[model samples]
Target: MKKIILIWFFMMFSMIFSETNSIYNTKIDMKRYPNASVVTLLDRESIIFNKDNSYIIKKHIIKRILNYKGKKASSEYKIKFDKRFEKVDIINAKTVKISKSGIKEIAVDKSKNIRIIDAPSDVGLMKYAAHKMEVIAFPAVNEGDIIDIEYTIKNNKKQKISGTVNFASREAVYNKVEIINIPKDMNFNITKFNWNTKMEYMDNIAKDRKIIKFSEKFMPQILDESNIPESLKFMPTVIFTNYNNWAEYRDELLGKFIKINKSKENLQILKEIKEKVLDKLITKDMTNMKKEEIIQDFIAKHIEIKYIDNLLDFEASSPKEILTRGYGTSLDIENLFLLLLKEEGISGEIVILGSDKLVWDDVKKGIDMNRFNYAISKVTIDNKDYFVDATNEFSKLGESVIENNIGLILDTGKPEFVNVKSIEKNITRIEKSYNIKIDLNGDALINKTIYFYGINAIGEREKYKYMTPIMKQQDYQKELGMISQNAYPISKQMDVELGSPVKISYTYKYTNFASIDGDFIYFDLPYRLDMLDLFENVRKYPFELVSDILRKNNISIEYPANYKVRIAPKSLEIKEKNMLIKRDLKIGNSNGGNKIILDTVVRYNSHIYTIEEYSKLYKILEKLNYPKNAKVLLEKE
Candidate 1:
């Protein structure tokens, strides 16, 4: 009996499928109730198969147009089916009907092989209603069978209106499906779109309003053995306008302005202002004071900067306001400085730049614009160029602010291209000497003096913020100990200080080196320490090729008294071009005591060397650690 009932249901569905070409129009009235109203329209779709295992889809579109507008809206709808069947189901029909005070729902049966029409709530029903009519058809296969689908849309309204009917089906099985032999007054638009053929790849389509069509051949998984029987799933996306247009729209809404350059006139005004400002600030009576000194003093006394505020409207304030406020952001100070320099007859341009820490390799490709962050000023003095950033309180006048490296400079007067020059790594060297007396009782008294000189000193001081208190002390001790292995005996009497190039001088005493094994006197020669250890284990990766490194060191040793040396005396000499190490020792006695002297130096031209070159240089230093004369022996009576 069940089989008979199923067969009868299939026959009835097939009959409806044969009439798939029938089109229906629906009108929705939204004013039936005080709060809301509704109306529904239904349609049938089918796929007809031939004996040759080929099939075609016949789409019948029924639209339920809703005209609704109110402070609040409500409605309910229901749809019924005689029997359930596979490949013949509602695309969007689910859930039981409910009051639409908010969004309600409609229910669908699960026993039917309907792929869609299972709306959990009223929102789904409304979405089904809003969908265009052309997407209502089912895909067809090569096998001979008829598919019948019925669906309805409801809207709460009383208005009377008419809507056009349209239908769509896959072109793979059915080459073309359209409303043929229609009236000439009907208007329509046909557009072609493309889809990604790759499987498992998410393709984002519909960034703009366009319909995409996919071929069955493009999706092999959806095809059957003969490549004729299969099902394809396509996403239904609508055509929407571009969203980026709103940015330009907002700009246009605000207003536009043209920039005019009065170069000659502006230059004269700038020159007059510079002279007046400098004359009042600089104490030098003569016009020929050193530029570095004048700029340094001016920056130290006048330039005041405050943390930038989001609400700050001006990009730059006037020089008078900057001086009065004593604080501004990079943009504010740089612009003000440029104005002052221009007033002083100096040709300066504002350069836009990315912060030093911000890498620009990819950003230069122009994917996005937010990569840029900081700015500075470039001044040409007597044909010499100098870059300045007044934003940094500690930065010197001629010093390139570390954060402003490689930043793009925007020139308002003339858009001339300006490049930021790279900074050379700072190298410092300290040399020290110790004089002491060693008695037969294995007791020694020592006095030590040290001298520091290099760019490394300034770099170390600049990095003080990154070091903990204990780490800083340890670092300082390690640095001082480099002059001599017995650094604990040395007390730092004077701290490091900066002058033109920066210098540090200190003195200390050691009482621990009094014990000796021989009656005559003996001492092990200090090993030569290479500054190249600073570059150890650094070039482990390919991307570290261009990073720069700084190296600095100080060494000191006391001359032994009444000493017998078996190895030759050792000495190292480092100059701008090459480094040389030589060791030779001989036993000797002096008026004060036995004396032994060891010297070594590893001279490098500059700290700025590429990773490849640095690796090569490091190899040379590694060779200096040869086991030659690593140990020395002395005799005593």
Candidate 2:
């Protein structure tokens, strides 16, 4: 009887908020995105900028659940806000379930389910300003239910930062609308990107403000597939900013940094610090490379760099304060190094850049300053430019921690942008050598050595520098297990230095790595340079490779004295548009036994290719995928 009464109470309570709202009255066409489990029924955003420069933003989102994946969408909702700059309030939220019988509505109980938690609000780190997010989980939502959410965010601190609203998402969008109301006195530039659907724009004159609106419907989903270009490059987006050009944005940042340096007290403080560094870390006879090594090591060890968000904490802290704290942000650490270099009589400047995959296109099309999300130091030694960042403890001198080898250098004095190249030859190469010995009983002992150069060396050093011996052994065994079973490590060694390639060597014993059938033995080759196997299907866009990839492999194998070469692939050399692959396999005699040797080299000369070139490349990859094996006959001669 109590259970029945509880169910009755829920049924009656759900009816309390059953009054139909205009948003819920809208219908959904399920046939549009048949494969989509959850469909965005409606997405609306409205922004109002008053004469006082304050901003008021309201957002409404409605989603329909079609299957199990859609049910995950109905589970909860969260809205984040920075307490110092913004306030968020949920105006209305509810879930509706429709079936053949009728429609059931359930209102979210804000007082009961909604709770605030301390979370990172945005990508910026402003610790003094506490950030929080309100998370609320819906009650009793099932498949086929529709969720409706509405909230408003008001910016109390009005700054000159531009606002960007992106209308495209991975999920299918049925309708999206954005409305902006600004006073006539305000000046703003509107830019749009990657818009496929037709957009309707309208301008209306209000008594106190000018209203601009943009609306679009039936927007298709943006698919994110493997090996495809970044979604941002193809996603539809609109941005509003008061600044007109990159020069204006550059000046603003320059002013902020210049103001910090102009203080007489700050200048004296930097001078004293630089004097200390020069006295302790630099010598008159030391080369630039040596000086850089010492200074980079000192900063990386002594100063703890914290990268919380894009905005570095050093932007606010004084040099003295940062040193005293023993912890600085990316900007702070770089700035300190710049000042130290200046005192040492070396000239350098900050290079502000964006992700290579994101910034170059925009920089050519009027320069979107917002794309510049990172900063590094660019210095000249012997008339050649080098980029460096001291933020990473594991990075060697003259290497950028960000690893994006492309961006724009901020010519501080001229307020101009200069392209910075991440020299291709500086980033990739691999050399692998394998030695294998197979016993008559099919057991084998294999030794492998890998040498990584340039960026690859840096990456490998960072990956394994902190791992324990046992952890490293486990990881090594996991990779080996993919080709053979019962892989036992006999020995392992690693050699790392600042100026040379990293070398990793290991020896393993495999119980049954080779198969013995009748009077023959067979084993698969290690590290085949086959490009076709890496890509199963051709892509719409040309495939990209790590620029300047160079790989070489040398393999030596020995078999029983009774064995002789029965079948082996002939040596082949193929060179085509930007790629070269050559293999030389030889059979010879050593100590009255059969010895087989394989040496191969694979080189990719270019970083990117056009579809026409890729089509030709694809055909070559298909040929490379064919199996080539060596079979040794065990019959005595």
Candidate 3:
């Protein structure tokens, strides 16, 4: 009886708003928003919090289509809700036409045309719980017609009353509003991200109700832009939560994690793995690094992580279930790592983080689980903390694949935030050693050994993991052809190990590498000295980098003993705020012939750069790439 009363109360306040409000009837000047395909007449959401911890979130939007794009874009809309957490209802969906006499409305039949499917929301980090969805289709949607949609998600999972409401739209919005109603005494955290406007609060709207309303006028449409760090940074949004503090959020998650480790079946499997990995041999003298390496490597090679995206959607299944299924979500996979660590008598914890894009300072505005995208394992060996992520099949130990600054370490009953400075500092390094021997005809046989470390090794391993030897040879041939038009690979060998460095050595022949003039031979260094062209444009948004890169290329060329060097490539050192590109030369004799050796290194030191910084980098690149400094001329003695 009480439950019925609570539902009625939430519905009363959530859906009782008048549609005759002036904003709904206001006419928009189409000329003001020429770029928009549609104009939002009214976009509003109402959140009513009940005393029983239930919530009814109602959204009402009215969009007027200006062209065919708008008609198609807004024709079918979807609403998702999990059966375990909430229920969804399409209160009203229709097309509105204003005529000379009156306003005509054509309502869509929810029971007939709605396609209900079991789909989950990919929350960036992994796929999360909102499974069931209703895709409502509007019939006979035409340009100049207004699409009005109203729906409500009745949530019973009151403990997790947190989400974001975006004010930005794909089309222009004339007026947007969000209204929240709670009990007079209840205080919820309201954080505005990328929103510059203010909300009005009526603390005493009723005898026991408090109302908070935010309204924005003339919101521009979201456009596809380059170099944007995150769309949320440019879009206006509001993230609200009732969790009081981080401790409360951590405690709830800790309770769930503690229950995950209590399964005996999973414990048995972990013990078996321990015996196999450690062998119960007292003579082995197992070391901490070896234990971590073997444990993480076993999981990385054996267990496959399902690439379903983000945090709030996946359930942390039992250890036995995860192993039995053969595949698990990233969180569940990492959870299994923590359980195994405990069985091995090694102290470690599972670390959770949103995208490495956001730090504690940004996400600290509210406790939101949807923002997280990564889960990793952390252990201390040799007094040094190492982070391990087994999600990347070719990832090395302590080499994280993502750029993140903060991690939430889930300790027993105590969750703490840790800085991921060490992993971000882990450079994806590549070293290329090239030995070239050129005959009097300017044709050369090149022997190259490429050493990849950190994430770079993982990338190379992943790139060739599924390819045949023939395919690898073809790929290497194509890469070698970058130096000379007729260059092709001869033979190549690769030793792939996920937790260690990956080395690839191949021999290729470069034909006509040097341009021959009557008595002088001119050759340019067969190296890509132009590294700054990747960010040459420096778009309106901030340039974002996922990881730092360090590339070292060493090239040695041997010519005839009778040739004397006339001109050598000039060395360069171009340094900026967050980047360094330097080249050095060592000239000497090798094997009774004149040898010209050049070493070049390029490093991008930061993850994010403003337009100003990029401009400075562009200037440096202009000087380094032009002026033909890599040209070397040799004349026969």
Candidate 4:
């Protein structure tokens, strides 16, 4: 009788789940995405808004694991939100394992393996916002198991923010379903981002409420690439907004700032900062540009910018609080910088900004004020405008991080979209000079001097300024491993000054720098030209070059006595509209030995390239990276 009941129960279970295209009945084919360790069988999210400005969101996710690596999908679950406006509740969760003989199920137990963390996991965050996260781990998870998660978030207050739902993840999904319900009379708009395929959607009127559903099937995973903008900017997503438009949003944001700027406490703090920090920087002989540079440098270095917020504090930090504490969130830092500039007689306004990736095709298609997650100050000088962000410690007076290029100026009360290009035209330049002395045994002593300009200088200065000499040497050893295995730094020096390119000079020795074959000797070229070729993989999506870069390398090699160069690669030069690469090799006589001087230069003019462009660049790289062609041969006289 017991066996009969067990069999009947499973039969009923299978029958109920075996409906057409139901997630519980779906079977993932392991061969479909061979590189993928797991697949999302279903991801459904539903939002129901009430008449009282509160809403409830239900999320259901089902994933099928294919291997041990796939277990990460079920190993842990985390949901983060602002505690002031949202509350999360786990409805029910379970994991099922099916084998040839039978099936086993395990349900989540909130009494064990669950934790609530109040602080952000990111170490860089310094804001004291009331943010919280609930984390849970599924039990009895293993390879080839299917995990299902169900949860709901209830809104506690009126919705001041828009919503965006992403259908793509690191794992492929067979089906994705999203639904939203609102009052029939509410005005709203939905925008699509990075959408490649069409989705089936339906609008229905159910009594006094309106319902919309969107469904898509067989969506592949978005491959992660370095240097590219984040997934939020380009992934397949649905953006729903009920706040009307950018103008309304900008007015509300700037209105708050204006009120704060008028506060007596805020004014006092600005006056104090000007007296203590700005007065010393202003010299009668200094130009306006110099004073601006000094003011920006002092704040960026002295005032720390961290992402610190609490659950109850969702608003941007007040200027007075930020100035008093000497540390604040990135937004706070930018707001404070704007106020400081105002005190210095510089006329500027805060500009809302978006990532460059968000403006790939056009700004209108993906335009959503919610996408503008950054703030910077823009000042016009002599009819020219300059944008800067104090949040970025290395940012210069007229330059900011490249990602924050697409901007909307909030100055005139009416927001106007602007393409905020860098005023610093020559952004990054690297110059490296090496003097090499080679012995008959093929060992070499090298004295190298490296110079960095613009962004490159700022980056190198920030990286080494705080590091100990021993730590810095250890870092160089790892970085130099590509050039020589036995490279060791002998002496090092750094020259960092305001308004000048940073220079790092060091001397190093390399054992067995050249290979010898009987009477013949060979030396490897010391410079690497193509930075993009380092990845070696052709990405499915567009790769970001980020910025214009110029790299120059000069090597002076003095070989041992009585040694003459037998062979050398032909000098090469290639130039295109977007890039330039050149290699020059000159041989001369020095100190009774053969002297070789090699110079290589590579310049990139653009920040983005299509896959087709990258393919062409790769072809050029093949010609430049030809190992046999890069060798310098030497023979006894």
What lDDT is reached at residue 481 by model 3?
A: 63
CA shift at 265, candidate 4, in angstroms? 3.7
Query: Candidate 2 on 505-611: residue-level lDDT in tens?
Result: 77888887667888777766665664722463555554555345678899888878787777665688989778898889998888876778989988876345655
The model with the greater TM-score, 2 or 3, is: 3
Model 4, poorest ten-residue lDDT window? 306-315
Candidate 4 local lDDT, residue 449? 79
TM-score of each: 0.43, 0.82, 0.85, 0.84
Q: In model 1, which regions exceed 4 Å deviation?
A: 1-277, 283-292, 300-314, 342-346, 355-362, 366-369, 412-492, 513-515, 519-547, 550-558, 564-637
- Model 1 agreement with the true structure over 19-41: per-residue lDDT tens digits: 43231111222332212221223
Model 4, backbone clash pairs (residues 3+ apart or across chains), number: 14
Q: Write the per-residue lDDT of candidate 3 for residues 1-637, one digit (tens) a residue.
A: 9999999998876665444434446777867777888888887888999876689989988888888988888888888777677888888898777657767788998677688877645333233434677888988788887888888999886665577777766578888888889887786888776766353333346788878887788875665554456545656677787767766755555676566576676667777766765455312467766766666766776677776544544556776776665767777888877666666566777777664543346566666656555677787766777777855656655676654557777665555787653354346778889898888888888888878777677687788888887887667666766656787666654333433567777787778888789889988776765453354454555566555678899999898888888998767787776788889988889879989999999998646666677667666766666647778899988
Choose 1 or 2, whichever is better by TM-score.
2
* Total backbone collisions for each predicted model: 71, 0, 11, 14
What does candidate 3 score on TM? Answer: 0.85
Identify the leading candidate in terms of TM-score. 3
Error of 3 at 402 (Å): 1.8
Residue 629's lDDT in candidate 2: 40
* lDDT ranking, high to low: 4, 3, 2, 1
- lDDT by residue (tens digit), candidate 4, 1-637: 9999999999988885674225655766657666788788888899988766578989988888777877865578888876767889998777877777666779988888678887465445545546688987888888878888889999877754576677666778898999989898877677776666476778999989999888888775776666555554556777786766677677666665676778887788778877876887786677666766777777787777664422113466676677667877655677777677677666776776664633544434534555676667787666678877766666565554553267767765555777665655536677899999988888889887777676666677678767886887677677667566788666663333433466666677888899888888898877666665437557676666656777899999999778788788668888887889988989999867779998988998755667787778877877677787678888887
